[model samples]
Target: MRTAICDMLGIELPLLAFSHCRDVVAAVTNAGGFGVLGAVTHTPEQLEHELAWIDEQVGGKPYGVDIIVPEKYEGQGEALSLDDLAARIPPEHHAFVDRLLREHGIDTTDRAELAGRGMNISDRIGERLLDVVFRHPVKLVANALGVPPRYMIDRARAEGVSVAALVGAKEHALRQVEAGVDILVAQGTEAGGHCGEVTTMVLVPEVVEAVKDVREVPVLAAGGIVTGRQMAAAIALGAAGAWTGSVWLTTEEAETAPYTVRKMVAATSRDTVRSRGRTGKPSRQLASAWTRAWDGPDSPGTLPLPLQSLVSEPALRHLDTLAEKGDRGAQELATYWVGQGVGLMNRVRPAKDVVYEIAEDFAEAAERLTGAIGD
Candidate 1:
């Protein structure tokens, strides 16, 4: 299980769990893997509070933080208020969302009230959150959508923290290394959340070979890596570790909506789709009525980045609430970001059990591989 990443991050297992839920992060970290908190959705105050709570739970175990600062978006570099961002979304898009919900017999009375509460997709907001993150004792800070902002890199270095970036292509990996990132997460399209159209099997090695001459940076294979066998495969492909997100969604400590978790547990690998309906960026999520409605031929086209969030988040939030209340239509429409590996995640286990099981499986896989090679 030893690798350069383990040495750098001071973690036992090379598995890095990314989750929005602090409980999942702490549980994984406590169980011997590195836990990275997805802080893109948290406000500065919320991030500060969550980090403090995680610090208390992990008892000095190393952890990381992930923030999204997309390279391109609707209002890049603008200091627009949430209300201003919401105003930029077209009225037709709003109508289209309402029509979709009504067609499914879901009520949308409080939909307007739910707007403007989406995750921060702007660099400006990310910087503010970074201010809060550097104040904490986090061992790593990651930028998910694009290169890490210069301020983020400089601040992390000043605070003695490592900087990581997620990339979907070899060129992106090279760009990150040239930008001085300490770690690169080669995330394939099968990954949940915003991703490009490259498969993990191809992207991992491509990135590894591409970045070797640039610098000896650690590459963590991500996207659809749920099992220890997959982790082993990633290592065989020249990855130093695995950066996982989807598997944690079905864990007992996950903050995923109850209805969404049920859907993920029952889902097959073929049951997901990469669509821009959710985030205006291609993210692999459960293929539900919601995604279908947006992707259908008659639907209005999606917006870009934060603008698309303005259109989708309110409706999705309402659907989650209704689904929780046992509305059949809402339940059918309930979906969350998950990788193709979800087909294998059929049960809800504790986060610690997941970490231990993955470690054991990885060991067994390695033993089998070694045994295959004759003396």
Candidate 2:
């Protein structure tokens, strides 16, 4: 816990939990760890409200916000409307979704009853969310997918907020450093959500060595890091801290869909697969009927980022509704982006308990390593 990251974050421990749920964020921060809110899915207005509520709950504890601005996606400076983006999704994809829904006995006729009926919006909305977080007391702002855009980096620097970038490769970490990112998140394939082929055990040291003399910025080990032992290992390998995500999904405060949380509890490390079916980029999620369809040779290849997002997002929303109503096939098809760490999460616990457990475990692990020296 006496690492550079703990000093930078002004906390006793260096466990950084990335979560979407406000309760989890508050709990982790209160337990002397950093809780980062994943804000890519929320609108600016909603994000502002969530941050304000977290501010009140954590009583001025430091936290972070994460956003997604992929280097390549469907709507790049074209200024496409939400309808335009929606239309780009091919009719065949829609038919495929409809067929899946019906095969699972989900009602397609009643669009009004859809779970996320009114939530669809434009990609430009993310900029507004970024602005809102900057106005608050957030200590860090992270770009989840790529190098920090110049505008975002400039704006955060102007506001005196630290900017972090998540990267799957050492090359990407170098690019982020060149772009003036204050921190590099070396995320490996074992991570949930978007990731690259390198394992955390390999990628962390590689990224650290790659950027060692460039700027002295911190490197947090990410991807498939779920326990105190894992955190200790990352620190031993030159990581300043452990950047985590999937562990939060099983927290009591998590907003994870009830059934999805159940699935995570029951899952093994091999239960997840990396596929482009969800976010266009390769993200690890539970292997299910939907993933099988996209990976099948007879099916059309998956589309690019936002285009693929367009198809997957609506279908997931619909699946949630069907899943709640006892549609077993739809339930079986239902999946969310999570890492192989799901196997390690056995029960729902409070986020603070999670933080303390990591700290305690990290101490024991470190002590054991020291004892092995037999000095």
Segments of candidate 1 deviating more than 4 angstroms: 112-116
What total of clashing residue pairs does each candidate reach? 0, 1
| Backbone-clash count (model 2) | 1
Regions of candidate 2 where Cα sits further than 4 Å from its true position? 112-124
Cα lDDT tens digits for candidate 2, 1-375: 488878777777888899988899889999999989988778778899999999999898899998877776776778877677777878887777777677767777875443232222345666677789887899988886777678889889898888989999989889899989998899999999889999999999999999987889899999888899999999998999999999999999998878888889999999999998887778899999888888777566777776777777777866765777777987888998889888898899988888888888898999999999968
lDDT of 1 by residue, 134-241 (tens): 877899999877887788888888889999999999988988998999999999999988889999999999999999998999999999999999999999999999
lDDT of 2 at 24: 91
RMSD of candidates 1 onward, in order:
1.2, 1.8
Error of 1 at 87 (Å): 0.4
Query: Which 10 consecutive residues of model 2 have the lowest summed lDDT?
Result: 113-122
